[model samples]
Target: MGKEFRNQLMKVQKQFPQIIKEVRGKGLLNAVELNSKALSPISAYDVCLKLKDRGILAKPTHDTIIRLTPPLSMSSEDLQEAPKALHALLEHDLPEMKKQKPETVSGTVPNVCDRCGRNLYG
Candidate 1:
């Protein structure tokens, strides 16, 4: 099941070489490394946010890698949807996201808390 899921994800990577740097993993634990240069102002967290909006929950690691660990009980059919959603996002939404400007921060631009968006440096 893990191999099948990784293969499906590899297909998505092939479809978007500019965005996906590599796809690697063992068992149900996998990571998608995105081209940081290609993503620019958009981080992996931003991509995860989009994925979340599409009903997928993924985590960002090292700012450019997305960690995917589906539950063990997930059926192969349901698991297949992950790659499809990723493909759709890269194909349709990414282009639009690229066009948008990064959010501008006023003043000193302190680092904010990820979960609550509070000013971490304050």
Candidate 2:
């Protein structure tokens, strides 16, 4: 389940190339950074708000960041559901944002920034 969860997270980063700056985790336990610079600059709080709307428990630890730390005994179905919920959070903006980027490396990366919703990195 651990490896599978990690892979799912990595896949999310790839699917939303420009909006996810990094996906790293030891297993089901993971941290995701929403690139706040690429184009849309989604705030971690915004993502969390969306997650809450979806009934997923998550928190923003820094700027444009969130952590997936479900219980160790979580089920496989739960694991599968998580990534999908996260995918939903960014689905609306990613397609257009991806098209706007010029680099294959893509654009993305985030930290919650100020209350005004800026990337903390810049």
Task: Measure candidate 1: CA RMSD.
Answer: 3.4
Candidate 1, run of 10 with poorest lDDT: 101-110
Worst 10 residues of 2 by lDDT: 101-110
Model 2 lDDT tens row, 42-120:
4577677668778788888765778888888989888777788888867864455445544423355436545657667
Candidate 1 clashing pairs, residues 3+ apart or interchain: none
Cα lDDT over the full model 1: 0.87
Candidate 1 wrongly placed segments (more than 4 Å): 103-122
Candidate 1 C-alpha lDDT tens digits along 1-122: 99999999999988899889999999999999999878876778888988988888999986699999999999989999889889988888887887795744545544885666878777
Best by TM-score: 1
lDDT of each: 0.87, 0.74
Q: How much does each candidate deviate from the true structure in C-alpha RMSD?
A: 3.4, 6.6
